[model samples]
Target chain A: MALCNYYRKRKLMDNLVGWWIRLMVFLVVALPLFITASLLSKSWLILGHISLPELLFSSVWRPLAGEFGFWPFIISSLWVTFIGLSLTAPVCLLSAIFLTYYGSRRLLGFMQPIIDILAGIPSVIYGVWGILVIVPAVGKYLAPMLGYESPGFSIMAGGIVLSVMLIPFVLNILIEIFRTVQHDLLDASLSLGASKWQTIKHVVLRKSFAGMISAFGLGLSRAFGETIAVLMVVGNVVGVPENLFQPGYPLPALIANNYGEMLSIPMFDSALMFAALLLMVVVVVFNMISRRTIIYLESRQ
Target chain B: MAMETTKLSIQNLNLWFGKQKILNNINIDIPENKVTVILGPSGCGKTTLMKTMNRLVDLQGGARTSGKIILDGEDILNTRRDIALVRQKMGLLSQRPTPLPMSIFNNVAYGLRLKGIRGRKKLTPLVEKHLIEANLWDEVRDRLHDPASRLSIGQQQRLCLARGLAVDPEIILADEPTSALDPISASVIENQFFKLKENYTILLVTHIMRQARRIADKVVFMYLGEVIEQADVHEFFNNPKQKMTRDYLQGAFY
Candidate 1:
């Protein structure tokens, strides 16, 4: 009977241990997301309760007056992302194609480490560098070229700086895609009388289109959500600036610049949270687009 | 069938990879409108020799060759257009296929497109004719629009054969085409070779002695990048002259 009791106790202890492990696993995987979910739900509630027209047309973000329209910031953010992807994807893709097809293996061995180092550098470092170098350089003559009277902090500067930062990421992703193309497939195309460039265009690029699309999609998200660099380079003003050199404030910039000062205004703080929610949506949509591309690639095979 | 007679002759051929002589003093003739099987052990420079025939080996930077590969009495090494023409006239399928990620029709049409044959009306009939000649039309006729990769391994091998034939090459070089297929599929491909012999000159490379015996009209038995013996297929199999060829035929090659 005493032996039976001991076995029973041991089994009970094992069950307790298993429950403890489950709890630990749940905490590790589920906690941060729990907090994020809570925050998201609260933002949705705030969005549901917010007064109408103030969310749309109003540009003045004076919390006391209850005028809050995020359109200008949204436009600026989208405009910057568009400009950045356009400039970055082409240059980076071309470089990657060059590196894969034209560049020697020796040159690739030399350039890869530099690209990695550039990838690891923080956004703040890019921002500080942009402020010190790009702002002054572009401001000198770009103001006239953009047809603006005077360039202060400019969208064009931010877009260009952001483009520079995005280059390495795009190049690395493209290189990885290019490298994954099968050598046999490449040989097959070339031996069939296609030229070297023709093989790259038809076989390598066509095969890697899904991966390339995903890489650019990820890069666009990064460029869109970029905060510190754009803040440093863009002249923060709340109107649609036709001139590229004109001052603009993206959504993240507004949240970053105003969240600390939004102490007294309850709706204002929630409005910033709403902007966070919108940014999350942007990231989610890009990821979905990338996922679709991946699915298409798998189906193609 | 309607036009020209072409032939391949290699004289005093030698190949080197960065001072390591892979093929030495190689000289041979592969006849036009015949099934020539090259029999050799692994690393005997059989693949290297096969690649050298169509100038595929020329793309390698440090791998050098000194030889005269005369196609139809013209030295191919002396001219770029000649090399291109040689490659265009010859279709090569490697030991393993390298099918493009495409529909069955596109994979066949790939070479045709490169040859500047456009317009659906022109391309469609050519694709069907080649597929029919390759013995793949019956299986794929209804599903020609499907991805080529969806086919079974046996079907893929035949599809590759169709792809090779689409370019209308007089010579077809298959480096172990059926090595990856099952016995049934291998036999199927081997049977297709007999039918193909009426049109295309075939240079087949395989480690399988049985396969070479079954299909080869002329056997060029090579060991270590050197031709041990050349004879009619019956003589090479039933009465091999070289001791090495006899050993290789009996699976005693080391």
Candidate 2:
């Protein structure tokens, strides 16, 4: 009778613990999604009769006059993200290859800690560095060399600073991914008389292609969402940039710069919320695509 | 019987990994167009010795070697010649099969493509030929373009064998090529070694005494990083010169 009572208490405890776990999991999973849906619904209702497609397609962004076209901001964001990705991914990939395949242990050990430190640095610090260093360098030398007048702030400066921020971030991830390429595979390629370059190109790169793409996606999302550093160097002008040296503004900077005046301006709150929704969608889409590609690659593996 | 000619000669080869001596004063004359199996217990530096022959040992960090590995009268230890060029003259099969992350056709074609062979017209027949030689063509001919990793472990090993042969190396270094395979696959690879000996000088490292007995024309018996006995297969087993070799053949190595 005593043993039966002990067993019944244990079963009751297990049921209680199981119920707690399910509730905890549900709260964790549903909280963010619930918040996002509620926010999106509020913005959609506030948007009222203003069709989203018109706002996206139109180039005018005069929120003061009730005109809320965000096409220029969208374009600028995409343009900067493109420039950052194009510059960062290849350079980071090559550096990763160099570190993993050709670097000596001592050199790698020294570089690794430095890379970790660089990755941990704040974005605002990068902004200050860009203003003090990159802007002046571009204004004094790079602009003149290219026969362009410099205002000391341009999309090019933003991209350069952003690339510097992203290289170590992407490189750290890629190096780990490349390291996962089995040593036996490398030996097989080498034993087949493949040079180091050939082996890296054909075997190592191919094996880690999905992971590398995911790394690029991370860089892309970060580039899209980055505000403070880009704001300091990107000139904060809301227009489609004509060239690399021209002033431009991205979506994150747009929202950050204008969020203070949102309550006073008519329909501006809804516009900015819509923009936030757009950014969220983009990040979600990129993450989804990368996750799907990684799953596919792993399935093949 | 035809007179055996030396294809590779190792003279007093010594290898160190960090501070530990892995291969100590090794000397061997590997005959051309024959299967020479290096039989020893695990961790006996048998794999290290085969890797040293191809200079694959040099790829390891903190690995240092002294003495010479002469291949066709060229000292492979010398750094003057291109490592890839030297490596191209020999092929190596690892213990586990690692197919390149590509289709079966591409895996075999990889080496040929690197050596400047291109165009589907040229690659298709050559890939098929090497696949046939590796004895994997009949099963995979229908799925040549499928991912190489889709094949079973045994088929992958044979595919790796085909990939190795695609380079047209004069010497084949196999490090326990069948250790990871089941009995059927092991027999298939053993049969491949027998057929391959007609054209390539095969250097195989295996701890399985029976495998060495079945396929070796010449045997190199290693113990504690030193070769204890090396002789013709029959002589080594029936009349071992060293007591160590006799004890090893009789399953005394622990």
For every candidate in turn, the CA RMSD to the true structure comes to 4.2, 2.3
RMSD of 2: 2.3
What lDDT would each prediction earn against the true structure?
A: 0.83, 0.89
Q: Write the per-residue lDDT of candidate 1 for residues B1-254, one digit (tens) a residue.
A: 23434478888999998889898888878877889999888899999998888777866667788879888777775555745556777888877767787899999998899899998899999999989988889999999889888998888888888888887788888999998888998898899999998888999998888888889988998888788898888999999888888887777855
| Global CA lDDT computed for model 1 | 0.83
Weakest ten-residue segment in model 2 chain A by summed lDDT: A42-51
| Candidate 2 collision pairs | none
Q: What does candidate 2's lDDT look like per residue over A22-48, in tens digits?
A: 999999999879867966985784467
Candidate 1 displacement at residue A221 in angstroms: 2.1
DockQ for every prediction shown: 0.53, 0.74
Error of 2 at A217 (Å): 0.8
lDDT of 1 at A14: 100
